[model samples]
Target: MTRSTITGTAPPEAGATDPGRTTAAVPRTGRLTPWLVLALVVLAGSAVLALTIGPANITAAEVLGSTRYHVLTWLAEHGLGFLDPGENPLSRIRDAIVWEGRAPRLFTAAAVGAGLALSGAVMQAITRNPLADPYLLGVSSGAALGAVAVLLLGFTLALPLAAFIGALAALGATLALAGIGGRLTPSRTILAGIAVAQGASALVSFAIVASAQGDSYREIINWLLGSVAGASWSSVAIAVGALVLIGTVLLASARTLDAFTFGDTAAASLGVHVTRTRWLLLTITALLVGAMVAVSGSIGFIGLVVPHVVRLLLGARHARLLPVAALVGAVFLLWADTGARTFFAPSEVPVGILTAAIGAPVFAWLLLRTRGQS
Candidate 1:
């Protein structure tokens, strides 16, 4: 398909005059400012619903109360005790709704959603291909090897750690494959991604088949299907750490990614060191995906769908697209998770299954739209 050339708007120069504040040091009103605000509201509402609307039927009020109490207690314990709230019924309910059950799951879902969406956006830019996603490009499979190995061997404690290593390894293999004949081109890079994904898939299958015994086989399948069930405080900690670390890194590199959206030659001419930037971006994305996949298994489509939605609304500027995409992604996953937890009641479906189900029709529509445009 022939893509529409993004034109008219000049890329915002870093450190330029702030158009919004009417000062030289101020930042301009990004073109998608209003849409971004709307996305934020959607995200907030979705998060609230995810936290409160389980089969257990916790209300939004209960969810908020619990979260607030926990935060205040944490603040007090950390020497910010002045922020503590007094005794209240809401606080008690909040304790039940937020701490024991929904908080960790909600956070994990948000983190995984944001991470996948962010990584997908970066990968699409890196490859100059709209079809790119962390999962589709083999980054998730790389992470999955570590996770799958964990399921196969019944490994505890170091599952996330192993997944991180596996992801880096898979990415390294993809890069090595791409650079086989010297320079890394888009076609070569995508081909390498395909090869790595297939290889990872083979290993995962072998692991599953080898452990086809009574216990591990079902565990393997469940793990592959992806779930946010059984999340705990430790998992939340890992996910939060991953989000803060990788989100910061990627946000810092927003300009570089934006440069990449214009294609490699243009990015290079605009002072982006294409090779180094791509390498670093890939590594960062792999790490983010690994951490998220480790916590949430392999929830799909939020990455692929959210960024495109953001692009449609925000016109493909990475600066605007990045945060907005993250928010929209978090919203999508939050609601999807709520559905997964509740739709079948006692029998929970994997969040990944729910996302794929939703994404299929969206994917079809997008393909049709692209074809018509072409």
Candidate 2:
């Protein structure tokens, strides 16, 4: 075949009359749309199931009733109601469990999952490394250190702010270390991040050992292990707000991320401001990771594994990959968190532990597959 036929770019003589031929070279949207729809459906169902699967044993009907009651109540309070305030079918306790307890936790899980997955995908792209994740820059470890300090010092109210500061500090330090020679290469960045992560982790351990006592130690350990157990509406607000804002920015920059796939020079040739874009994206990612860790602790592997799984199914085009990965991550973590809480009954496993248990094997398989391909 001629080059024109192989690449689907027609010769100059044929281009004027056969413009439709170029369409064949594009990735098929039909093949991807169904998967995206399926992911959304699964996420919706998972959210419902997660809301019902806690220790309370609330049925689907009660969950639905509670949600409807709260919506109507809010509407009535805001003078937009078409229903009576007294029409709630769920009892007060069940309503509270569904609305106050499970709902916030599930929402926080979904937001954190989506944010982490998106951040991972972007990091992998920007760094040109398949194994890169949100924590590759030490954001999680730094956030953990800040969170541990807050728990130790009894400044729980400032946990989120402290974590954010810690994450930014770690990022700054990583960048400074990586840019020692006035150039930021992926290898240098990764090495610097590892150093930062180790240092932050040590600080966390020392803080815990020095200050934690009894329940404080347990709480610190639980937070380090990652759980959404104490999630409140306020936690939901923080997570969802960060996910909506930073996640939207990341998703909108999908084309720019795609540019980075071809390396800095090529992306610059394509009119992408490589350094500025990279810095902006990295800072945004740090913010998302910090916010998530602040709310849900350092949940592991959702970021690392979700994007790889999605990429295996959807290919590596960022536009399609980002949204689908976000949905899949949300669904995956919702179930994982649910299993963490209910799998062993009364005693709870950390959600991070469950993710690591599942992710480690999946990661091993992926590594083997990648090696075989190589």
Candidate 3:
């Protein structure tokens, strides 16, 4: 184990993962070809279904038509065969629904999932906590309290801002509580997050109970539980920006993050600024989570589960696990959201509920495995 120099902060710089071995000499971790091909096809297929499948009842063929037309139109070709502008009512509405309405939401789901999962992986490494997750750390709950209050008070204009404020404040509180003398420990950090979650939950209850508009509470609660139902380009822009910023920062510190897993004292011995890096990284992650929760609501389990799954597959290396976890998170949430919206047809369940249902069983199985190993 050697201390590596931290380079200029941006997307990660590719370096030789195995220092002693050249590329040709390095052994393949496993057969990634099949999985890589599968992931590509799934992503592409998911995009098609995400664009086409919704409450709108548009067919995949119409989605292909509109998408093909866009590509061919760019090439000055006329063979895409998109229906005429006013020839059919179904095609017109179908194009609008798929291209305009659903695509952005689905893209947001993928991006948000990746962002949350990436952040979670970093946090788990930084804190050395298997249970670390964005939503579980009170970031989502704090954002929900702020966003929910804004909704109930007819301050839709300020909802995102309010959510950001709550998220930052919550992070501040968590850090303050976690600090001892001047530094934080992983256990303290986890405890503070749990306390903040409880506090935010109480605040949410009060806000809902005191709302003047009783009718809006159900819809507001649904949003708190998380949904990408009304996601649009404007909000997706914010999510995408958060994803890029946080993903870059975390990946930049991947080696340092891996060091933290060996314990803070051990990491510090390796020339990593154990305390300062943890503070900066955790705050950055909280900011990212807060921003995500504002738009997508409190989509849970993604932050906790995706990283663990990736670690299990990749053998605890942050470099490989981080990117793969991001992809898995994206794919998992996109499909989870799809199931929530489509499983019951005319009625859509909150995706959060679906995530919880799927995550809980998997979580139990994981716990059982851990116990068995112990």
Candidate 4:
């Protein structure tokens, strides 16, 4: 079928910003700006609510008041003394809970969610696979192995750095395996990733068995299951930094990604450097996923589910889809992590478990719906 037929719309106008692009058709009754604004507002509200709903029993008013006071204090410290009104409404403990504990975790959630969703969307587009996820490249498994190794071996290197290295190593292995005979086909890439992920996971299990002792198993298992409870300002920095650095490049390459919807041959015909672009986008995605996994472990399904939901609402234009998916993913995960922490009260569940529980059902429904349509 032609690109237009597949997209269910004609190609964009020649003089349009995205000329010749095939954006998925959705109803044109509503403007994108309003939806985007709504998503942003929801995300902001979710972050605040997540901050308030932790085990401390803090009120929304208290959270807001504390946030305001800190903002004013920071401004005052930075030569904008006029911004300070000299009122401290929150106690030190409350401030610590908000600023040091919940706030960093929430920020990390937003960054990780955004990065994973964007990475998944790009992966699906480039590979033309509905089931593609950030972990499809074995990055998450690789990261888990790295963290387990560090824990077992008592390595002085930070867990995040080690996990990032492991993720890169897995990506290298995947690429090498997939590109063995000729061009990297999607089937070959997926199979290679599966192999790498299984190998890395086995290695992680071996490391745990050999070195993990008593409570070490608890720590290793928790990290593997993925929790944001341990998030700190450093984790926030790593997640946000990776999102900004790599996410920007991915967003800038939206046109290239959109072109890939029509396959590599069509993308090449449209002046896209198909091979180089694929490599560059995949590498950037791997880096983003690795950094996030380093901070939060391998939280699943944000990447797999968020983009598809966003596409349903906003259509398949990467220009619109990428940002919207990021925002929606941020909101979804902020709430999901909040549930993980608060749902079981004093005993916290891993955020990854919650996502999988939620995502697996949703994925099944999506699969059935797609099959019905076909």
Q: In TM-score terms, which candidate is top? A: 4
Model 1: colliding residue pairs: 18-26, 66-94
Going through the candidates in the order shown, the clash numbers are 2, 0, 0, 0
lDDT of each: 0.75, 0.84, 0.77, 0.85
- Pitting candidate 2 against candidate 3, the one with the higher lDDT is 2
Report the C-alpha lDDT of model 4 over 1-374, residue by residue, as the tens digit. Answer: 01111332434552367534533344523456667788889988888878888666888888888788888888888888776556666688878888987899999988988988999999999889988999998999999988987888888788899999989999999999999988887788889999999999999988988889888788888889888888999999999999988888887887788898888899999999887788778888998999999999999988999999888776787877888888888887888888988899889999999999999898888788778766
Q: Write the per-residue lDDT of candidate 2 for residues 126-171, one digit (tens) a residue.
A: 9998889999999889888887878897775577778777887888
Tell me model 2's lDDT, rounded to 2 decimals.
0.84
lDDT of 3 by residue, 1-374 (tens): 11223232433433446554433323325544444456667877887876666676677777776676666565455564354432232466666777677777787888888888888898888888888888646787788878877888677666667887888778888888889575688888888889998999898888888873655887787878888877888678888889888788887787888788789889999999988998899989888888888778888888888888777665576766676777788888888888877898778888889998998888788788779756
Model 2 residue 33 CA deviation in Å = 3.4
Q: Select the stronger candidate by TM-score from 2 and 3.
A: 2
Show model 4 residue runs off by greater than 4 Å. 1-30
* Candidate 1, 1-374: lDDT as tens digits: 11223433655783366565533422233445566677778887777766667555667776666667767888888889987565543545546655667777877887788888888888788878888887654766777788777767677747767777777788889889988876777778788989998999899888877776766676656667777876777788888788789888887777788787678889999999888888777777877887887777777777787788777656676777787788778777877887888899878888889999998788778888779766
Model 2: weakest 10-residue lDDT segment is: 1-10
TM-score of 3: 0.83
Winner by lDDT: 4
Which residue ranges in model 2 land beyond 4 Å of their true spot?
1-31, 155-157
Name the runs in model 1 displaced over 4 angstroms.
1-31, 88-94, 154-157
Off by over 4 Å in 3: 1-28, 31-38, 55-61, 71-90
Residue 266 miss distance in model 1 (angstroms): 2.0
